[model samples]
Target: MELLDFARGPAMEWAFAIFIIGVLWRLFGIFFLHHRRDLNEPRHGGAAPWWGAVKTVFSRMWPRREFRERNTYSTVLGYVSHIGLAIVVFGGAFHLLFIRDLFGVSWPALPTAFVYLSGVVALVAFIALLVRRITHPVLRLLSNFDDYFSWFVAVAPLVTGLMAVAHLGARYETLLAIHILSFQLLLVWFPFGKLMHAFLFVPARAVTGYVFTRRGAAT
Candidate 1:
């Protein structure tokens, strides 16, 4: 009937479907495209020992040692944005409600104040990332169309979510509609864009670390 009604109905369904399917597609693509490269072969090294690979990923985010050696402001911003967004997505009350409505699943939600704080953190981190991308020369040089598009696509939901909470501009329903629409766009673009890195990054990092460790380049 009305746009608000649609947002709470078909739009929600479509957004959830696209998100699930898109994530699956991206994971599948990464799994199929990358042959298991060996990490210890004499030339290229055989594959890293499985346990070692796991350890590498779990330890890769440490601020000291090799992780910090490679770090830059852009990396810091990216990490902060990802962490904040994960907190908001997994901890927010509205997200829990949406899950209950769509999937008949429920989880404990963060406190209302925490939900608002998480949203603000996610939004601030996202804006910092955007500014970093524009100002950082190396990042700018490395960025392609997909990189720029992915930033906006990922950030749009957070911005609209804040607006939705404040009931700014249009009603909450309209803000929510905009949020869901942006999320759908992100889902559709994910598999074909740099955003697929979300699915691939862990494995990729593991393989790199393993290769270097076996070669005595990383310790």
Candidate 2:
């Protein structure tokens, strides 16, 4: 089969299926298998576990004062890069069209020009992050194969996409197929790697907030 057909056909199907199943399995395992009875009593009468979780979800979006003071630039850069990537993935016209085609759901999309700009910025941001990981003493010491692998998979789609858009390398069809295939690889990798943090962090932060609330402390 031609590369394009394979990428868009069976490869896409299997990658998507694995992505969905893996993510669901991980989530179910987290919620079902990890529960243990809290033997200890709440410190402050245990008033609002669920409410605390909800509150923490929004509260922790902004960094604490100490962290903000220390890493203000890094934090802001992270947010901008993340938000830019989100705009490209979730708000781009082509992306939204694909979402609609797959899920029968539709939403307004951002302008194509903006999406393109955000894509460029996100590419730069991820490159910077990878450089930091490689160069920083502590991060380099702690890094492993998963770190580099995840970065490559995360960045591959964007690089191929930008190349396709710019018509800079191979034929447009080939570049586009590479872009889609890279994204498929990303989907397959997402649940198995640190990328799972995208989904897992919610429950984790919520539980942390719940504990803090039980102690009568603010999240």
Candidate 3:
């Protein structure tokens, strides 16, 4: 179908181009920003800032003890969505095939059923997070258009891909085209949104940890 062709062709190419350029542009800006040297010497001896940075990145993966009670469910759902998305994207056979075709790299695929299960769980976990963002008093007060729009674009591909696979509500070709286009939407929005956090979170945590350690402050 012409629609499918366009979706798979120019739309995908343009979206991928925008994605790469935008992400590189942002990364270069961030990485090249001039950092003012700390004029003061480190306050804490044996703090080992580099080691602190590495440790903090891993440690921050889980909430601190005092915050665990209120954050447990939210944290669990976050991991569920993140892990599930990783599995579905990197381990699925079809996805791997796409990667192979695009970049000429190949890897072993997960079982099809497992990949589908991961996708379903990811969608559910992400939706739960979205609901919390909408209903939680502080979160809702702080939320803006970017938050909601990022969620929409991120979820669209997952929903459409599942629908396309299940042949729900449309012809196979049409559904496939919709799925691809939805993915392109995600690509186009990824670098310009909170979705950029996907790439920045690790560095952010590490940098914060290093700074806090050097100042002998609790993270």
Candidate 4:
């Protein structure tokens, strides 16, 4: 099959299926595998658990004292890259049309030039983070195969996407196919890797907040 057909047809379908199934399986395993209950007495508590959880989740959006002092640059890079990539992927006019066709919903999209610029910024930030991971002793020590592999999978789409947009190194059809294929690979890798944190962090933060609130610590 042609690259375009394979990417848009079977490959895209496979990626979506694996993404949905893998996410569901991983989530189920997290909730069901952990059955231990905390039996320790609470130190003090006035706030509702739900309220504490909600508060903690939103409060963490602002950097903590330690993050600001110790890793402010890294934190800023993370925010910039993540937010920029999200805009490029979900706020682009082309992407909005695709979303509308697939899901029967539509929304305003950012201008194409802005979307392109955001994608470039996101790619640059991602590369910077990878360089930091490689150069920093502590981060390098903590890093493993999954970290690098996830980085590759995550960045491949951005690189190919830029190539597609610029019509560079190949025909546009081929570049678009490669871009879609890279995204599909990312979806397939998401569930088993640190990428799962995107989905897992919400509940994890909520539980952490609930526990902290029960212990009378400020969230």
Candidate 5:
């Protein structure tokens, strides 16, 4: 009860504050970066810049043709886990409640059983990803603390959340508290880590597409 109280009260407040501030800071930096003036006339036979920007954001979801075969398995599983996580976060009743409490938003939620199953699937995908990273030579060479810690934070909430739902390892309150704490850890690290890619990737890719379109090449 005490743990739950702390997690639901002070820790939640602090974590939410830090997450908001950190995300805004990173976004401000991205928007304020120096830009080179576009002096050249618009090139012919290229994608329209603004339309290309919007198009590339969705187009880049899949791997390029040249890299498709080599990375197909990883890419597919990544999407599975990503979609699962998205369902768990945005479609769960409890998650929607949290969002409603946080941002005054409201929406219909999927069945609890479905949300639980999605969490389980997402967790499994993350485990497979870790195993692949450990065994693949090139991936192992590139792996670092950021890679592992980000994985931990990403997976921790899922593991703890499942545990909470099942009432395993502790009383429900304690388990729930730990689950919330794990999520808070994720929130704290999100903006400073690879998780920022969730918010940054679309804009960055759009800008890349726009710039390339301006150069008369779109890839």
Candidate 6:
């Protein structure tokens, strides 16, 4: 019942430090590589006009836009997982309390029920994404180590958190410890993995739109 006692102290500190460094490295790599793309040339042919590219992105992401078609299931699931994870991370009571305690900043905490619901939603969304990868020919063809690893990285925290919440294992402390460790691992892996899409997606979308618009393709 004494969950806090599971702290590994020094080892945890070292692990957290390494994770932070790895995340930074990954983020730097993504932004660095993205900047290298040729902005003038279309990534694919038949792109729309330049202005059209900007319009497309905003229109689709905007609420209640009938003109915007749904993205592919893979894309939708990917966004869902990311959004759900964000809700869990920023809206959770623990994260808010941590910020208040450590940095003297506070935000309204999501209700405990909402926190658990977000975890469930994120888990389902991640699994749906994995299934899309497995079932879709194009996605399966594109699959690589990072693709699978990213799913595992994204799902681990949710699974562990749910287990900890349920208190199902022999040692609740052990389960809680694993949950914390998994969460830390996710943060470390985030910047380096496909999860960096969080940072890169907007830029990538803009570039993709520009390229398509130039070629007179989908707007």
> Which scores greater on lDDT, model 1 or model 2?
2
CA-RMSD of model 4:
1.5
Q: lDDT tens digits, residues 124-161, model 5?
A: 99899999999999999999999999999999998998
What TM-score do all the candidates reach, one by one? 0.80, 0.90, 0.95, 0.94, 0.94, 0.71
For residues 1-219, what per-residue lDDT tens digits would candidate 4 score against the true structure?
A: 399999999999999999999999998888789567778677654887678898988888768886778687788889899999999989888888889988999999998999999999999999999999999999999999999999999989989998899999998999999999999999999998999999988888899899988777888
**In candidate 2, which residue pairs get closer than 3 Å at backbone N, Cα or C atoms, i.e. clash?**
none
Better of 1 and 5 by lDDT: 5
Specify the poorest-scoring 10-residue window by lDDT in model 4: 40-49
Give residue 191's error in model 6 in angstroms.
2.8
Please give the RMSD of candidate 1 to the true structure: 3.6
**Candidate 6 lDDT over residue span 31-78, tens digit each:** 666455445754454434667667766755643445336445556676
Of 2 and 4, the candidate ranking higher by lDDT: 4
What would the TM-score be for candidate 5 when compared with the true structure?
0.94
Q: Rate the local accuracy (lDDT) of all candidates.
A: 0.74, 0.85, 0.91, 0.90, 0.91, 0.73
Give residue 18's error in model 3 in angstroms: 0.5
Cα miss at 28, model 5 (Å)? 0.6
Q: Candidate 1 residues 96-141, lDDT tens each?
A: 8877876798889877787777778777878887777788788788
Q: Which has the greatest TM-score?
A: 3
lDDT of 3 at 146: 97
Tens-place lDDT digits, model 3, residues 6-120: 9989999999999999999999999999999987678766667887888899999899999999999999999999899899889988789889999999989999899889999
What C-alpha lDDT does candidate 2 achieve relative to the native structure? Answer: 0.85
lDDT minimum window of 10 residues, candidate 3: 39-48
